[model samples]
Target: MAEYLKLGVKNEPAMSQASLGFVGRSVAVAVVEDISHNLDPNLFTALKDAALSTNPDESKQAVKAALAHGTHPEDIADFYIPALARDMGDLWCADQLSFAGVTIGVSRLQAMLRALGPNWASDNATTNENASILLIVPQDVYHTLGAIVLSSQLRRKGFSVKLFLGGKPEDIANHITRTKTDAVFISSSAGETLEKLRQIIEVIRGSSGATCPIVIGGSILDVQEIHDVTALTGADYATKLPDEALKLCGLQETEKKKISARNGT
Candidate 1:
């Protein structure tokens, strides 16, 4: 973990324009395949089109259509948005959409995420707020909708989650030291960002100490082996599953909390 901080945030590879296509296509196929079964195919297409459209109300209407179709908001946020983000990335890589078009699409998706609900990022449903998690997304990461949705999911499960979109390693360390964090989750998207993860993990270990577990997730995990990421970054665990992450950190929720969250009680 000490190795993580030496390189710190300063060395994160800037996502050059040339590599954007590579990064986009690298993970898109897997993401598309993952959500194909869970989401309504028609609704997914509508959301993608709305996000890519210029009309501001188009995305809103798409979301409304989803709700009217009896789709849950959580499902839209968790499954659909991430899949759509990847589809947009794939489109950009295929030259079907200009860079500016993809950017607008991603921005609209983010706006829709915020509109999911007041508690999308924080749920008071669970009384166990003592267990907390720090969810981080390096500044270079392009798709953060997954991390945000994960935050909501974790909060619903009774964990107090603190999410950091992007920040310097020192800032991250300082925050970890200041807060009583049980686990640290760093989400990465591109292959070029792997080395930077090593640095960030090091910083997290440096400040939070070896006792606190670090788990890496996001699109990178979809394409890479779990062992590869953990071995490279010196993270305690690497997975996209929240339950596994919590278990690794020795903070898994009680069965009662889990049941309650599922029952929406």
Candidate 2:
């Protein structure tokens, strides 16, 4: 067996055992590391110039060339493309990147996993044959990128999701009444919104008789906080990916045991 692995790029070596798979991971890492380390200072400058240039076709050509010459197409499509589109305020381009078969890179994979919540909920809905999921975001929390990504992931995973983005408390109550959803997901990008979220949970509980589980997630709910909030709301907190969240809500003993073991309990 070859002890030394030459990743697809010219001079990079495989950094981890997991990268040895014959798929794109090794090549992807090599390309990203190489470009990050050796690309000239002018590359990003050129890309920005192209993104901001007056001639649309020429600007796109320039950006494409920059991506093609220095970075793997997968990396560009997955990580760089979305980040660039976001930084540039071009959501249309970001949507294009999602559909462009961009293999999610390691750094961005965490966000992608976070987005998988709705999918897991949807799967649970179908399997039970009597349940559905309502994905809820607060009125003030405008960051729906995670939700949008998660919605798509859930759809791909064969779950139905009704996304109520930035809804008022009344709107959420009305949605729950109408849909009789199996689960509700509340996501916040900031910790400052925790009080507001707590209020919303209280309102939902008071009005809905605590019928459905309200799952909270995002950067705000780290490990300890997930448990605490779940206790506070009398709902559940999804500390892991969406699938894990769904399993927790459904109370699947085997899945719960597996998660416990993974968590070293």
Candidate 3:
């Protein structure tokens, strides 16, 4: 967690050695696969060794250095999710697993902002006041890291956002009905469970009676074919992340202004 914070603040050199030890080999591999071009090999080697080390302090320092090297938020997110999920089963209270997932997801998002720099949000803000949004993920889409990261980005950009995850279709409909949401974001990482996402979208759209925007995302929709699937199922917006989806929905500027004002900038 300290590594996550250090990366977010761009205080790369300040990360404690112990924090790096928590990052695992899979995380190192993911980081390399995602950002090897931007990072030094020696730093990565140190991270890998730390991940593999039995010594707790050495491992922590190594992970800290790798994080300090910085990588894209999406890649960081991908690296953190599995590691978080594995550790969650033992660390989190049984009833709080979902909350833990949300925390892990948001932390990765902060890491992304750290790696990508804060200027990324500048390109997408809008002045429109009517650009409210709602981000919804299917009840079974337990991998909330992507959605949470996207939500954090959108919130930072000033969009009015209501994040809902892992709920029944009826619950989704009820929220849409009550909020009159301008957009709905859905995430489905499951390969075979896409039908469930479709059904929920259809149900929400049909029940809303208005042509509310629907966005679909996740590993399943990472493919071009899934874009077509999203269209076929009546999703008006589709992207791999919430930031991109908001761009598709024409709310970028409005969100940015809101964020800027909130930050007193």
Candidate 4:
């Protein structure tokens, strides 16, 4: 893969594994490994460029070319596309791209995933029908690429996910109540910030009481921040990765057990 890409680089094993979920002996874990190990660096570059392209057709061609080698669509959606989004974030932080450009890049990634057809999410979903999840993308925040990607991941894992965005606290709470969702998710960057997220949690809890689980995730959710989020906001689980958030909510099962999940306490 690197030979075609001409980039003598590989993400560390730990970093690669974290993007999917904690690697395990499961078939799902193995599939993630297959895609992670197979990404061509050149393909990755082209994807990044495509995502940031101003012309939608140009972006399509870039994604089309990457898959020309018979690359799995899931590999692009689940692996490379996400990596490109993060790369766009990195470039934004370095002043290489503006916020608008980054947003467009993420939109492009979503467009590519949407183009892959209906089978992609179902192919990845577990048959268990484990949990009903409310994936919230709060108002006043623009970047939803991670949430978009995470929604697909959760759907793939058998959660009936409803994505919420730009709604009032009452509306959000009402939707959760109306749908009887089992889990509520809030990313740090989803709304104004973590502090605002704390308020969202408070409002949801106030409206719903203690029945539904509130889970928090995002790039900002390191171990300490996770503890802080739960402590400060009355949230039940916090994770740095979207898939790990599922584990924290105890929505999926595997051969080994993790101790951190509170399962909505």
Candidate 5:
């Protein structure tokens, strides 16, 4: 985990860019395939197009069809949904699409997620027994889809996560202590200026939960910004993506111990 922070946020690899044709392997394929074997081409394209569509009803039909055909909710959430976002980001940068379009796209995707609500929770018995993790959406921030995605991934990996969508620092601290949270995660946003990061960090530091490690990230933080934030704040670790956040917080690996114990290895 320390190694990842040291290396910092990576540009989407050269290989990933070349494989946009859906002809090869990448983190998306590897991660999504592990959860579901039914990677239907139609399902994949349906999700992609639905996220970019302007019409809510049409997008709903595509997302619903994918779910009805046995594409797992977790798969859609973690896999195809983020891909659409990235694609939108690229288009926006190139001025081919408006930011408003991207926002609408995500709203449509969220509709699919809301529709798939309960199935998103993990059924793993070990997860229910795991230590608590608090995912806080810090003050004044609205979108927390990144944190939500990490929470789902963590739960699937057998960690108990409590996502605090919005709250005061003292209240957040009280909840963390009452739950005996093992760690906490928070995110700014894609365009965060970090003008208030220091204040936000201080609030977390003053809390009873301050002793637990805090991992922070936002889309705006490039490799240099990540290092800068780490240097300027009480953050123990940083990453541009939530998967790395889980690794740095050391939650993603805990499930391995359960498997080893069951095998008596």
Candidate 6:
């Protein structure tokens, strides 16, 4: 990652594995390391520039070049694309990019992910009911790139993911009542109020009969502390890591566990 992209983002101090419980922390660390190791910095720069360029075809050409270099489509969708989105968000925060610039960049990223094919989501779904999830972005929250990327991630993890973007609390609750959602993951932005989250979560709880686990994530988690979200929103858990959220809901098994079970070890 470029140092310039790190502007306005809070950096966490180093801590021992024992100081923080290692299980979830280790998983998050491994995820970061995996993306950093696989992503080509040069290609990332090109992709970022292309996505923000005036011509829409520039982004496609960049993605084509990435694929030609033998880059896995999933890697592009999961790691490269999300990193670009995050950078755009950080740039917007630092006043380096306007809201319009970030919006355009994110739209291009979404199109690029879609061009990667059905395999990015559906091919990996495996149609397991246990993996069914409802991903929500509360009404008035403008930061949707993270939610879109997360939906793709969850789908690629074999979860049947549904996105409810900017829906009213009553409507969101109605959908929850109709769907077989194993968990409800809400993606919120920084400017959104805690009272709004509380109200939405309250409605979702009523609709879900208080059985579904509601996990809040997105840029809100980046700016606000996790403990504060859980405390203020009546959420079951709070984290930006998809794996952690799913594990907390008892929906997703660890990769190690999945591999061991598959290998009969």
Best by lDDT: 6
Candidate 2, position 88, lDDT: 35
Off by over 4 Å in 3: 1-129, 190-192, 241-243, 253-265
The stretch of ten residues in a row with the least summed lDDT in candidate 4 is 22-31
RMSD of each candidate?
Answer: 9.4, 15.2, 11.8, 10.6, 11.0, 9.4
Model 6 clash pairs are none
The lDDT of each candidate is 0.71, 0.49, 0.51, 0.61, 0.58, 0.71
RMSD (CA, angstroms), candidate 2: 15.2
Give me the runs in candidate 2 sitting further than 4 Å from their true place.
Answer: 1-131, 222-224, 251-265
Segments of candidate 4 deviating more than 4 angstroms: 1-38, 93-95, 117-130, 190-194, 222-224, 254-265
lDDT string, candidate 4, 24-131, tens digits: 100011012234466689788777666665557866787677678788777777788766666665664454555445555666777887776454334234334446
* lDDT of residue 261 for candidate 5: 72
Residue 113 error, candidate 2, Å = 16
Give the candidate order by descending lDDT. Answer: 6, 1, 4, 5, 3, 2
Which candidate has the highest TM-score of all? 1
Cα TM-score of candidate 3: 0.53
Candidate 6 deviant stretches above 4 angstroms: 1-37, 90-97, 119-126, 254-265
| Model 3 agreement with the true structure over 1-265: per-residue lDDT tens digits | 3232221222224324333222211111111123334544564445433333334355445445556666444443344433433343333233222332334433443343334434333323433346656666666444555555555456555555666767788887787777656677776553425566668878887778856777776665544475576766667765665556777776676566766887899
Each candidate's number of clashing pairs is: 2, 2, 17, 2, 0, 0
* TM-score of decoy 2: 0.50
Give the distance in Å from residue 237's predicted Cα in candidate 2 to where it truly belongs: 1.9
Candidates sorted on TM-score, descending: 1, 6, 4, 5, 3, 2
Estimate, for each residue in 81-164, the C-alpha lDDT of model 5 and write its tens digit.
655555555654454544455456556656666566554443232334655677777664555555556666667666777777
Model 4 TM-score relative to the real fold? 0.71
| Least well predicted 10-residue stretch by lDDT in candidate 3 | 23-32
Residue 247 lDDT in model 3?
Answer: 76
